[model samples]
Target: MLFLNRADAGRRLATRLTGFAGPDTIVLGLPRGGVPVALEVARALGAPLDVVVVRKLGSPLNPEYALGAIGAGGVRVVDTDAMRALGVTAREIDSTEVRERAELERRTVRFRGTRAELDLAGKTAIVVDDGIATGSTARAACLIVREMGASRIVLAVPVAPRDWIARIGGAADEFVCLETPAHFFAVGQWYADFTQTTDEEVSAALATTRVT
Candidate 1:
């Protein structure tokens, strides 16, 4: 609970990531809420900025609970423990994934009208998000970039629980976070001015900046 807004959070996180600045560094921003924060980091790091889409495969019983996540072009991540604990069947998981895949396609169209995915091969990629609540979506993003052959992947976020952050520490080559408090709540609670990011806002952020 240390940030006033997404912009402020990005600046603080960017400061901590100063060591990784270089020509081959690529910034991949998760859209919806993460774009604003990612914009700041991309600017500060002087790296290429791009968006990586990941849709949540919500549980059939509790739609809000993310049992897994799916990335564009069909990459997927499922929490096997959660699925078993909730008694989620393969059919349900498949159905949810289908729905999320369509949603991810829609987002891709909205965010990138005619733009293509940034080249990540042989580059040091920094994946950015506003914060980590479940970390499922962020993890999915990291996997997608890694598949694209990023030399090193750094998962960066403004705030997250220490436990969740530790879980992802080994997944990425580097992990940069500003606040990892024990009293973790929703990512919004940590921000004084957390707001829903609109499709228009996402498009505008990408259009105005030359990072990508």
Candidate 2:
């Protein structure tokens, strides 16, 4: 199924997640693209929305290839097999992580400013993203939320590969996806307008939700 944009995808994804709507449930979006999609879900569910800042640790050789991911509260998910196969050393991984961690901090500050992070203690956290590709960032987000004391975790996305569950099934208690296309190539391929979401757009989305 092709989506007009992230908003369209989020509305579709929210339909699959009606069971999660409640006071105890909170929606966390992976910025900056995920925020738009998640905003729609939050509106539909009447759940508080927040950002789960995570960064993809790209391989040293091929920057597009993810070696792992890092999230808030020092949560990290490294792919040992991928590192060994790519001949990536510990030093290389450390360097990559350092770079990503800095960006993650910057984004957190930019998006959240001085606001305290949402208290996830004993609450149900629904992690939302526009789509899943490598699934590394989504996994890291789940771990971060779990660390924050969420009682239950749900990973929701609009689209993913048919084998996506196998890739990220262990991260959350429940997984809700709108589409798992068999011939999936990339997340952007399924969207008519896959425009890059900006920091301002993310901030605006958060600001609007904070008041409502």
Candidate 3:
């Protein structure tokens, strides 16, 4: 099914996640695109919403390739196999991590402002993304949430390829992907209008979910 947009996709995805609504549940969206989709889920579930800022440690020569990712609180996940195959050095990884971590911190502040991060200890942490592509960043998010002491981790997205389920399923306690197309090319292809979600939209969505 083609989604009208992320908001529409999110509302549809939220229906599949109705059973997870509770005080112990916290919905965390991967920023830039995932926040709008997550807002709908949070609203439908009556759960608190937050952004989990993570930066892709792109390959030095090919910026599109993610060799690793860095999350909040210094959480890092690396693909050693990819690094080794690409002849990436430890020094290169460290330098790339430093650069990405700096941007991650900046985005965390920009998106969340004064809102203290929700303590995920013993809570059901639901990580939401608009869609999954390479699944590296989403895998990194699940690991980071697990490190934060979450009792359970659920990875939810509007759409993904079947390969992603096989790829990152181990990281999440439960995977709640709405549509897993066999011929998936890109996340945007499944949407009618997959425009880039702006920073203002993300910040506004977060404000609507802020604890009063």
Specify the highest-TM-score model's number: 3
Judge candidate 1 against the unseen true structure and give its global Cα lDDT, from 0 to 1: 0.83
lDDT of 2: 0.88
* Model 3: lDDT of residue 95: 93
- Name the weakest run of 10 consecutive residues (lDDT summed) in model 3: 63-72
Give the Å shift of residue 54 in candidate 3.
0.3
Question: What's model 1's TM-score?
Answer: 0.86
Could you estimate the TM-score for every candidate? 0.86, 0.87, 0.91
Candidate 3 lDDT over 99-209, as tens digits, reads: 888888999999988888888899999999999988977987887888778999999999999888777857899999989998999999999999999999999998999
Residue runs of model 3 more than 4 Å from their true location after superposition: 61-65, 79-87
Summarize candidate 2's per-residue lDDT along 1-212 as a digit string, tens digits.
89999999999988988899988999999998899999999999999899999787788878867777787767787879989999999899999999899999899989987777788999999999999998877877887788788999999999998888787757799998988988888999999999999999998888877633
lDDT scores in order: 0.83, 0.88, 0.89
Per residue, candidate 1 scores C-alpha lDDT tens digits across 1-212 of 56888889988889988888999987888998998998889889987678888777888987867777777666777778989999999889999888888989999989977887778889999999999987877876786788778989999998888887665645577788888888987899988999888889888878766453
The list of candidate 1 runs beyond 4 A from truth reads 59-68, 77-90
CA shift of 96, model 3, Å = 0.5
The 10 consecutive residues of candidate 1 with the worst lDDT sum are: 164-173
